[model samples]
Target: MLVKYRGSYEKVAMGLLSFIPDLKDLNNLTNEMTLYQKDESHVLYLWKNKDNDFSGVVGVEVADKYIVVRQISLIPSERGTGNSLEILDELHQLYPDQNMMGSFDTTKLVAKWTEHNRHLNTEV
Candidate 1:
């Protein structure tokens, strides 16, 4: 199941960094989250396993009538199982009227997956 994440989910969110080597530092993640939260510009949701284990997080920033996906990360153990797509679908359903955009490093595997699943342009 997916749930809104509060400050307590910080650790689990930080743990997800292992999947993205360039973002292995918790301090950087914390700083970004803190800034976003303080600015009231971001909302985060987490997907939990049946036992309530943290599986992944989807971060979105609202911009006018659209929602820009800042990041979506799944733990290594949960990769390739369609959990990320499930999360994206839930977010889309929750805000059906809003345009959703997901951004990622163009060189990463995530960029390829996002383009395939969301049908977004690779050049962006």
Candidate 2:
């Protein structure tokens, strides 16, 4: 499940976000987290596995007309297991009323994922 990020989950969120190459720097990652924490329009969601262990972090910016995906990364163990897609699916469910988009940092992956799953003709 996708859960809103909280200060208490700092370590978990950091660990998951670290999987992203661009966020490997602690300073850069923390800055990104701070934006989500302090900015009302930015959101960070931590994904919990069935065992209740945190495994992913998906960030988005709430724009006037859409939710722009800002970042997404899964725990190494969760990669290649379709967990990222599952996370995206849940994000779509949460904001079905608005168009789900991707910012520069996320557009490529989002497009590829959506393209691969276009067979469903549904949000991916």
Candidate 3:
């Protein structure tokens, strides 16, 4: 089971930044998602398991009507179980009404798997 909810970027940013301080910009980056929730300009989704375990997050930024998947991450334990792809799929389904554009980063083996499964470009 997956749950989707509207949340404050401050809370998410605080939690994520504690782990990656360099991601401080994420706090501000998510602002667009917060403000334009219905415009499809940007959106953020946090993923949790059926057991309510926090898994990861995916964020997309829309520019020039292009949906750029800006970030996606899963906790260590959930990495190999296909939860990440499920999250991505959920996001895609959520915004099926839009035309999206983005490339997956394939430098990491896990990224390659995600790209292959999702059928998205992995050069980035």
Candidate 4:
């Protein structure tokens, strides 16, 4: 499940975001969070797994025609478990009318999810 980021989740969000290499630095992480909080176009979400634990974080920039995934990270235990795909799926549900894209860092992850979704739809 995707939980829209709130001020209360700052620590959790930062912790998850730190999993991303580029955001490991405290300064960069703080700036990134500020961008999400200050800019209406950019939004952040926390992923709550089936056990009801927050284990992932995704940041996106919402445009008129598409949502660009800026960053996505999951704890080591959750990596390679298809949870990232699920996070993207929920984002798609939230903005069904818009296409999904990704930033330089997350382009491949978004592409993989898009292809996977396309394959699923074609099979249906």
> Which candidate number would show the highest TM-score if scored against the true structure?
4
Q: Rank the candidates by TM-score, best first.
A: 4, 2, 1, 3
Candidate 1 vs candidate 4, TM-score winner: 4
- Report the lDDT tens digits of candidate 4 across residue range 6-114: 9999999999999999999999999999999999999999999999999999999999999999999999999999999999999999999999998999899999998
- The sequence of per-residue lDDT tens digits that candidate 1 reaches over residues 22-67 is 5666667667667656767688777886567888877788777888
Whole-model lDDT values for every prediction: 0.70, 0.86, 0.56, 0.95
The runs of at least 3 residues in candidate 2 whose Cα sits more than 4 Å from the true structure, single-residue gaps closed, are 122-124
Poorest 10 consecutive residues by lDDT, candidate 1: 105-114
Collision pairs in model 2 = none
Query: Which one wins by TM-score: 1 or 2?
Result: 2
Between candidates 2 and 4, the one scoring higher on lDDT is: 4
- Local distance difference test, candidate 1: 0.70
Q: Candidate 4 versus the native: TM-score?
A: 0.97
Report residue 93 deviation for candidate 3 (angstroms).
0.8
Give the per-residue lDDT of model 3 (tens digit) for 30-87.
5544553665655666778767866676666766544566666666677778775677
In terms of TM-score, which candidate is stronger, 1 or 3?
1
Clashes of 4: 0
RMSD of 4: 0.7
* Tens-digit lDDT string for candidate 2 (10-118): 8888888899899899899889888988999999999998889998899998877789898898878888887877888898888877777888887877786677668
